[model samples]
Target: MENLNNNEYQKFADKKVPKPTYLKNVILAFLVGGAICTIAQGVTNFLESQGYNEDLCGMGTSIVMIFIGSLLTGLGVYDKIGKVGGAGAAVPITGFANSIVAPAMEFKREGFIFGVAAKMFIIAGPVLVYGIGSSIIAGLLSILFKG
Candidate 1:
């Protein structure tokens, strides 16, 4: 009877939950990333095919993507996509825009000062800092090289 109880305890304690494989996650990430890039490329191609200049096509593609992201965000759809796509959604510029807007939306209820205005840039602060810092460093290096 003691051995039976011991066996039952062991069985309960030794139960294991299976986890998704790393390779499966990696493959899903890759596919989602590729799909996003492909959509961006298609937008560019469509713009060019419609007689837009290359620069305009590029800008339009960016604008369209950001608009789509913002719209999805406003409609609460982008959050769902973000949850599923993870790094795939995050690595794109649209994701950067979403990051900025989403936080602002969330904090909007706390009043404009501490909530909307303050949090508007919260997600983008690091990105802006790094971007400006890199540009300054690059400009300084260019000036030094010229001298």
Candidate 2:
């Protein structure tokens, strides 16, 4: 094992590593992402048909999608979807819900306050912080440039 030099060892290791299926992964991600968007659009359409105002329809659609994501995560289905869909499943609002719920579920053995609540935001905290921060910065810039 110690006989080979760095260059030889690197070449051996590179050959041993499996190559990724880039085209297949891309197709799966595109299909899964499109499916998620289709479901969300269906929800929005249904809400709109029920006489919901545009704002309410948007809010309701978000709520339903989040609930579906959290439910799927709890039921152990979302993880499978994530494995297959890769970033496709992780880029939507449903994926955001999964991120929030997944850590909480994993740490629930520690108790509600320290486990569930504390770990709940572990994944989504940075996202929320940066998202809100960026929005605030953008708003300020917009106002400044409004002259």
lDDT of each: 0.85, 0.96
Candidate 1 scores a C-alpha RMSD against the true structure in Å of 6.7
Which candidate's lDDT is highest? 2
Clashing pairs in 2: none
lDDT of 2 by residue, 1-147 (tens): 677699988998999999999999999999998999999999999999999999999999999999999999999999999999998999999999999999999999999999999999999999999999999999999999994
Backbone collision count in every prediction?
0, 0
Cα displacement (angstroms), candidate 1, residue 70, comes to 1.1
Candidate 1 Cα lDDT to native: 0.85
TM-score of 2: 0.90
Q: What TM-score, computed on C-alpha atoms, does each candidate reach?
A: 0.77, 0.90
